[model samples]
Target chain A: MMGAPLLEVRNLESFYGPIMAIRGVSLSVEEGQIVTVLGANGAGKSTLLKTISGIMDPEKGSVSFDGAEIQGEEPHRIVSRGIVHVPEGREVFPLLSVDENLSLGAYTRKDRSAIERDREMVFEYFPILAERRHQEAGTLSGGQQQMLAIGRGLMLRPRIMLLDEPSLGLSPLLVQEIFAILGRLNREEGVTMMLVEQNARIALELAHVGYVMEIGRIVMNGDADRLMQSEDIKAFYLGQQEAGQRSEKRWKRKKTWR
Target chain B: MDGVQLLVSGLANGCVYGLIALGFVLIYKATEAVNFAQGDFMMLGAFVTLGLTNAEYLHLPFWIAAPLAILIMAFFGYLLDLLILRHLFGQSQTAVVILTIALGFVIRFVAGVIWGHEPQTLESPLAFGDVSLGGVVLGMADVAVIVVTVLLTWSLYQFFQRTKLGLAMQAASQNQMAAYFMGIPVKRVQGLIWGLSGATAAVAGILFASKGAIDPNAGLLGIKAFAAAVIGGFGSLPGALAGGLIVGVIEPFAARYLAAGYSQIAPYALLLAVLVFRPHGLFSQVRTKKV
Candidate 1:
C-alpha cells in the first residue's frame, strides 16, 4: 500500500450498448499480491476484469499497469505488455489440441527455447494435460478445461494475471485444488493476480486484499481478514451471523445491505 | 477405355475446383464469413494473367505472368481487408455476408470493364499434345493440374500443421476472442489470411483458364466452389478438397452416362442430399454451445 501499485485503476467506466456495466470503479493491486473482487451475479465483476485487460474498452478513466496507461489498447497489445486475461467460462479453443492451446498461450513471445521450456512447465503443473496433449480440448471435463485455461495463461509468463470466475462451474474438491494452485503460483512464482469470483469464502481465504462490488460499484474495500470479520459481510456474503446459531429463520431477520 | 478417359478428365477438373474451394474454405475458416467475392477473385486472376500474357497487352511469358498475377491478387486481398472488411468487424454476420455478395458484383463489373465481353484463352507451358495410354488420352495440361493440386494441398497441410504462423491462423479461426487474449494480432492475421486465400484463388483461376476460354462471367464459378465448401463442410480444409473433387467428378459422369441435363443439376442434388444427411459436412466438428 505504500509504494506505487503494479496495477492501478481510477474512475473506470464501461458500457454495453446503452447500459453501464461498470461505473467509476477504482482499485489497485500491488506486485505479487493476490487481490480478489467478490460480488454476486450481475454485479459487473467480469466487466471490471475485462475492461482492465483490454477485452472491452472503457469510456472514462484510466488503467495503468507497471506505471504505463493501457486504456483502449488492443487485447493482444495488452497481453504483450505483460497482462493476460483468462476470460470467463474458460474459453479454450475447442478444436485445437491441448498442446496446441498451450503453444498458443506463448504466441506473443519470440524466445524459442523459453517457449519450449514453458510448455514443459505447464505440462508439469497439469499432468493430465500432458496425458491428453494430443486430444482435442473440447473433450476435456469442466474441471480439466478450467485447468487448461489457467495452464494456457501461465504459458504467457505474465506479470499480472486477471482471472474471471475460475470456480464458476467447478466441483468443491476441484475448486480447492485450483485455489491451491493459484495460491502456490502467487507464493512461489510471485505472479500478481486479480481474481474476480462469486465464491466469497474461498476467495477471501486466498486473497490478501478484497473488494466487494454491487451493481457496477465498489461498495466496500478492506484487508481480506478484516472484511471476513465485518458484521455486514457476514450477514450478506458469508450468511454466517454471531446470534443466528444456524436457525432456519436466519433469512427472515438478516439485514439488507442494498 | 471411355470410362477411364472420362475419369481422368473428371479428376483434372475436380482438382481445379478443389483449388478454388480451398480459397473459399480458407476465408470462411478465418473470418466465419462466406466470401461471395472468392470466385470473382479467381476471375480477376485470369484477367490479370491474360493482360500480362496477351500479345496486345503486357505480352509477358506465361511463367512471369502467372507468378506476377498471383502476387497482385495477394496484395489485392490484403488491401480488401485493410480498406473494407476491417471496418466491418463486430457488425452482424448477415451484414458482412451481404456486403461480400455486393463485393462479388463489383469485382465482376470491374473485371468486365478491364478485360471485355469476349472469352479469352490462357496459354500455359503445358498446353501441348495429349499423352495417350493404350486407348485413353490425357492432356498435358490435365497432368499439370493434378501435380499442382497435390503439391499445393501438401504444402498447405505442412503450413497449418508445422509452421507457427499457420498455427496462429488456425487459432484465430477457431476462436477470435481467445486468440486475441493469447496475444495474437488477430486483425493482422485476418488480413494475411485474406491475402493467402486470394493467392490460392489466383492459382485456381490460372489452372482453370489453361483448360478452356475464360470470360468475366467466369466468376460465377465461385458458386461451384461455394457448393464444394458446403459439401466438404464449410470450415474444414480437407473437406473443401473432397467436396470439390466429388462435385467435379460427378458432373462429367452424369453428362456421359445419364444426360447433359442431369450434369447441370448433379452438384445441387448432391448438396441437398448431404444437407439432409449431414448438415455439418463430412469433416466438421459438431459444437455444442455452453451455457
Candidate 2:
C-alpha cells in the first residue's frame, strides 16, 4: 500500500485476431498479498493473466513488474524476472516424469544445490508428487496433475505466481485442499499470487482483494470481505436467490453500480 | 566363415543406416516436421568432408576434416531452421512435408553441381586395415563404423537422460506452451535439435564414405533409413537403430540366399509387414497430445 505494487498492469488491451479479448483492463497485485479475479466463462480472466505473464503480448498499455517495464518480453524472460504463469488445464508435460517436470521449472536458475533443495521443498508441499516422482505425469489423475502443476510452479521460487483456474474440473474437496496450500504459500513463503477462478466463494475467502470481471472489463473491485457481502455478488455468484426472484430473470436484472 | 563375414559387413552397413535414421527421429521428435531431406543433409556432410580432405581441395587429414564437416553441417542446420523453417510455424503438417521434399531436391541439385555425379572414395586411416578374429576377418572401416555407432548412441542416450538441456528439449518436444511457461527457450532448443541431427547425419555420411564410395545419389539411402525409423517406431530412439540393423542384416542375406533383386526390396517388404501388423511401430511410445 505504501509503494508500487509488485505487479501492475495499466489500461492493457490484447486481441485475438480482430476481436479484442482484454479491453483496457487495469489491476495490480501488491507484494505478499493474494488477489483473486472472479469472472464467468468468456470474461477474459485467462487472457488477462496470459498478457501479464508475457504468454500473449498486449496490443496496448504497460506491464511493470517490481517497477520495471516488462511488456512484450518473452514468456521465459518474464519467468526469469520472478513471475511464473501456471497455465490453465494444468499444462504439465504429459510425457515427462513428475521429477523431470519439476526440474524444468527451475530451468532458468543455475544454482545446483539450491535447485535440488527446492525440488525437495516442492515435494514437501505436494507429498503425493514425491511418491509418484518416477511416473509419467500424464498417467496421473486430474487432481494429482493439478498438484504437480502447482508444485512445478513453486520450483521456480517465483516472486509472483499467476494461476489460472487452479480449481477447474476439480471436485470441491480437492479444490479446498489445493486452495489451502495456496493460502499457506502466500502466508509462509510470501509468494504473491493473482488467482483467476470461477468459484467465487472459496476465492474470496482466500484473497485479500477481489476483482469482478465481465466481458473483458473489470466491473467491480473491492476488499474481499466487503465484496463477499455485496448484494449483487450474493445474488449472482454465491447462488443466493432472493425470495420470489426467478432464476431466469437474474441475468436480466441490471447491477446497481451500472 | 562366410556367414560371419556377411553379418559383420551387414552390421557395419546397418550402423550407417541407423545413424541417418537417428537424424530423422531427432528432428521429428523436436519439431514434428519430417525432414525428407535428412538424406540430403548426409550427402552434404559427405561433400563438405570431401572438400576439406580431398587432394584437389583443402587436402586436410580425414581426422580433422570429419569433425570440421560435422560442425559446419550443424551450423547449417541451425541456420536453416532459424531462417526458413521457423517461419513455417502454425502451418499445416502437409505443407511442411511438401516443403522438405522440395528442399531435398534443392540440396541434391546443389550438391551435384558442387561435387559432381561421379562416385568418389574418401581417404581414411581405416581404409585398408583389417582385424581377424578367429576364422573371420573384418575390415577396419566396418569395425570403425560399428564402434562409432555404439559410442554415439550411448552418448546420445546419456545426454537425453541426464543433461538439463537435454531434458528441456524433451519437455519442449512434449508441450511447447508448457515449456515456454517453464522459462525454457523453446525455439532455441529446437534449433539445437536440428543442429544435433545434422551432426549425426554427418557421422553417418563419413562412415558410409569410409566403407566404400559416395556419389551425390548416395543420400537416397536415407529412404532405407526412413523405413528403419518407421519399423523402430518413429518416436523411439533405440528402435531406429534396431530397425536399421534389421534392414542392414536382411539385405545381405537376401542377396546371398535369395534372388539378386530381392535384396533391394527386402527392407521395404519388412516395412510393409511392420506397418500391417504393428502400425505404431515395433517399440512405439507415441501418445496422443493432451488437449
Candidate 3:
C-alpha cells in the first residue's frame, strides 16, 4: 500500500466491564479495499468493529483514520468524520419507514442535492427498499433488513464502513446476492470496508485481505487467496477433514495456528 | 341548553388538562422519566406571563406576553436538561422521578416567593366577552382556549409527522444507540425535546390562567392532568389529550348529578377504573423494547 492506509488500529483493547473483549489487535485497511475479519462466535470480531467505529471506547490503543486519531470520540462524531458502522442484527429503527431510515443515514450531510442523488443511488442498489420505502422497517424480512442496513450505510457516502456482519441470518443464495452487491459497491463506488463475518467462504472470496481471530486475538493475517489455501484454515474453518477422521476427534485436536 | 353549556366549559378545561398531559408525554417519550414538576412548570409559566403582562410589571399585551412566556420557558427547559438532567443519565429512572418531585417543590416555593400566595387573574382581550349560540352561551375565553388547543395539536402533529427534525426526534426516542450511529446527536435532540415540553407546558399554563384564577398552588391541577395522561395511554400524544378531555368532562357532570364534593374524586376514580380494566390506558402505544 502506498501512503497511509485509510484506517489503522494499533494495540486496540476494549472491555465489557473488566472482561477484555479485544486485546492488542493491530490491523489496517487501505483505501477502497475490502478487509474481512473471520472468527467463530465470541472471537471479538464485533467488538473490534465497535471499537473502530467509536461505539465502544478502547481502554488502550489508537484508531487513526486518514492520519487523524479518533479514539474515544463519540459515535456520532466519528460518523460525521465519514465512518459509518452497520451494527450487528441490522439495527434499523423498527418503527421508522425505510425512507426515513435512509434519510437518517445521511443525517450528517448538508448538501441537499447530493443527498437526493445518494438517496436515488441507494434505491438503485436495493430496489426492494425503494418499493417498501414507506413501510415500517420492522416488517422487513431478515434478508431485506440486512440489505436496508447496507443501503443506509451507503447514504453516508462514507470513506470507510465497518460492517459487523452482512451475511448473518441470511440464506445461502441471499448471502451470495448481498456479497455480489458489496463487491460491486467497493469496485464501483470505492467505499472502503472492514467486514467482520462468521461465514468465511464468501467473505474470503470478496475480500482483498483476511484476518483470522480466535479468543480475542488475531492468530493469522495474510492475503485472501493465501488464507483460503492454508491447510489450517481449510481444516478448521472450511469444514474440510482428512479421510477416516471422526468429527469428535477433529474438535479435540488443538488448533495449529494457536 | 344547560347540557351544551356544561360541555363547552368542560371541553375548555379538558384542553388545558390535555396540553399539560402533552408536556408529560413528550418528556416521558424521549427520556422515559416522568417529570413530577410538570405541573409546577405550568405554574411557573403562568407566573412568568403574569410578570410580563401585569399592570404593575412589564405590562405587555396578552398576545405578546404569551408567546414570550412560552419561549422563555422553552429555553429554561433546555437549560434544565443540559445542566441538571443531563447528569442524571445512566442513573436509575427512579432517581429522575424523585429529583423531579423535589424540583416541583422548589418551583412551588420559588413561585410563592415571586408571585405571592394570592391568586391572580390574567388579563386577556377575550376576558370580558361571551358568545351566544341560540339558547347556549359560551364565554369568549372558553372558545379561544378550544381554538388554540386544536391549532396547537394540529401543528404539533404536522411537526412530528413531516419535518426531518421531527422524524429524527422520533428516531432518537425509539432507539438512542441506533440514532447516534446515524449521526443524529441524540443528546442535543433530547435537550430539544425538553424545550418543546416546556413550551407545551407554558401554553397549558396560559390557557388555564386565562379561564380561571392562578396561584402558586394552581400547579396542583397537574395531578388531574397526570390522571388524564394515564387514562389516554401515556405513550400516545392524542391519547393524552383524549384522556384530559375524559377527566375534564367527568368532573362537572359528577359534581352536578352526583352528591356534593363527588367531582373532586371523579377523575381519580376514573383513573383507578382504567388502571384495573385497561392498565395500559385507552390508546396504548406500548411496545416491548427490541433487544
Candidate 3 scores a C-alpha RMSD against the true structure in Å of 2.1
Compute the lDDT of residue B238 as modeled in candidate 3: 96
C-alpha lDDT (0 to 100) for residue A3 of candidate 2 = 92
Error of 3 at A106 (Å): 0.9
Tens digits of per-residue lDDT, candidate 1, B1-291, equal: 888877778888888788888898899889988888888898899889989998888899989999999999999999999999999998987888899899988988988888888898887676677998786788888888888889989999999999889999999998888998899999999999999998998988888888889999898988888888899998899999999889888988999877767779998999999899999887676666353
For residues B95-128, write the lDDT of model 3, one tens digit per residue: 9999999999999999999889999988866567
Top-scoring candidate (DockQ): 1
lDDT (10s digit) by residue, model 2, range A24-61: 99999999999999999989999898888888899999
Instruction: Tell me the TM-score of each prediction against the true structure.
Output: 0.96, 0.95, 0.95
RMSD of each: 1.8, 2.0, 2.1
**What TM-score quantifies how close candidate 3 is to the native fold?**
0.95
For all candidates, the clash counts are 0, 0, 0
DockQ, every prediction? 0.70, 0.66, 0.55
Question: Candidate 2: where are CA atoms >4 Å away?
Answer: A244-252, A255-258, B288-291
Which consecutive 10 residues in model 3 chain A have the weakest lDDT in total? Answer: A242-251
RMSD of 1: 1.8
Ordered by TM-score, highest first, the candidates read 1, 2, 3
